[model samples]
Target: MTTATVPAPSTRADAPSASSAYRLSFGHLLRSEWIKLTTLRSTWWSIGLVALVSIGLSLLMATSLASFAGDVPPMPVVEANRQAVQVVVFSTVLTQLLAMILGTITVTGEYSTGMIRSTLTAAPGRVAALFAKAIVLAVTMFVSSVVVFTAAALVSGPILPTGPLDLGYPDSSVLPVLGAALYLALIAVMGVGVGFIIRNGPGALAAGIGLVFVAPILVMFFPRVESFQWIHDAAGYLPSNAGQSLFMGSPMTGITLEPAPALVTVLAWTAVVIAGGIAVLKTRDA
Candidate 1:
């Protein structure tokens, strides 16, 4: 059978193996998630709304508060800084809602459109994929929030009663503004976990809304009954309530934790929700 030997099919030394060629790295996964997040129309709309609402609220609050500048004595440096910081971040309430909806859609939209199957097939590691999506969402939300907060600060700076309301003089607003951005980022990440748990956009959104807004309001009334005072106290540990403590100048209607405790509480809630999501992802079909 030496008649015309095929020369062993001439494999090239540099040729990539099938596994290596198809392997998806974490960087690739991140890039893919970034693309998915940026290409969606809803993402743009949410971002636009964030900017619009933040700046609009900043103007409204600044002007309304400035009207009382003459009636009230000049605020102390610390108090004025706090008020300015509060005005700059006043829009966080609505922006957090937008962030939650956007984060939920980031995951649920994939499920609804049947893209998650393809994503899983490519990434293979379900947990890594979920984490990649969350990281991307968190980064996007943080950056967007920073920009919006900065814009709000600048827009409101001149309108605020200038004597004590200095955005840069005491540097008091910096940490709070940064904290607000971080808070929004964490909220978005929590929303990602909710998306994974619910896997339905509307349901996930409703759950997020309840957690962020309705739950706090409902819990506020619990203290009035005296027996449920513990519940009202416990409500301060809720994710949104705890997160708000990071930036808000004053406490909510219920018991409130200190800033450090609030940060820890928010982080704990996010970690628990994300762990639950990972557990569901591993045990369920894509």
Candidate 2:
């Protein structure tokens, strides 16, 4: 019998490995998050809702503005165009709730379904996972919001005069037009951070809504109690108020913050939320 020359397992250099190990990386985490996001029907519904709200309200606003004949004081064409852009951007307020819900669900949904255990098991780095999810959420929301605003601009173009509203893409006013979309993306990431901290859908949703909607109301309401000047000024720095300042328009006499300060405040708020999420993401249970 040919001494079963099953030559000892070849450990020679350049030998083809029998097995391979794959390490999870940021790209893999991001791809996984994207897959999870796209597979959900809510993502499509939210995007559709954003489009419907932005376009519907934008057209309605433009039509209404155009109909204002002799009753209102005549305004300059520049002012009219500014108001139109403001109205178009305002439509995003309603759609932002959808973005927030999407962001919250990105992480909280996994926890609700007990899928987080598998996710953590695969990655073993909660912060990396959360960061990836945040990136996905922010990018999608940004693109969706940009599309919504683009649709709004197209609809508003036909109704408004031939000034800034006519093919406004090349105008200087485009800065705030694009800035509003970027702001929505930031809001979405803020939702992701909150979701990671809460780890529950309903709770995270409520928290997000309260922060953008209710918190400003409460903060503004405080001044009515004692008519405190500082309290009233402080309201301008609230999250929603800051976001509103980001839109291109003349700030209402006293209610809105300066755009520069508001931008800083909004960035600070997002940073705080992300830091909180990072601190607890690794320490908390799935």
Instruction: Please list all clashing residue pairs in model 1, or write none if there are none.
Output: none
TM-score of 2: 0.85
lDDT of candidates 1 onward, in order: 0.86, 0.76
Q: In model 2, where is the ten-residue run with the lowest total lDDT?
A: 163-172
Clashes of each: 0, 0
Model 2 sits at a Cα RMSD from the real structure of: 4.2
Residue-level lDDT for 153 in candidate 1: 87
Which runs of model 1 end up more than 4 angstroms from their true locations?
Answer: 1-15, 18-22, 162-171, 223-225
lDDT of 2 by residue, 1-286 (tens): 5665444557666556655345577888999999999999988988888888888888787777668644667566656656767867877567668777888887788888999898889888678888888898888888878788877887776775432353444343566777788888888888888888888788999999988877766764454445576776776776667877877543322267766787898788888988988887778777
Off by over 4 Å in 2: 1-21, 70-77, 161-172, 220-227, 248-255
lDDT tens digits, residue span 80-103, model 1: 788888899888877889988998
Cα displacement (angstroms), candidate 2, residue 261, comes to 2.1
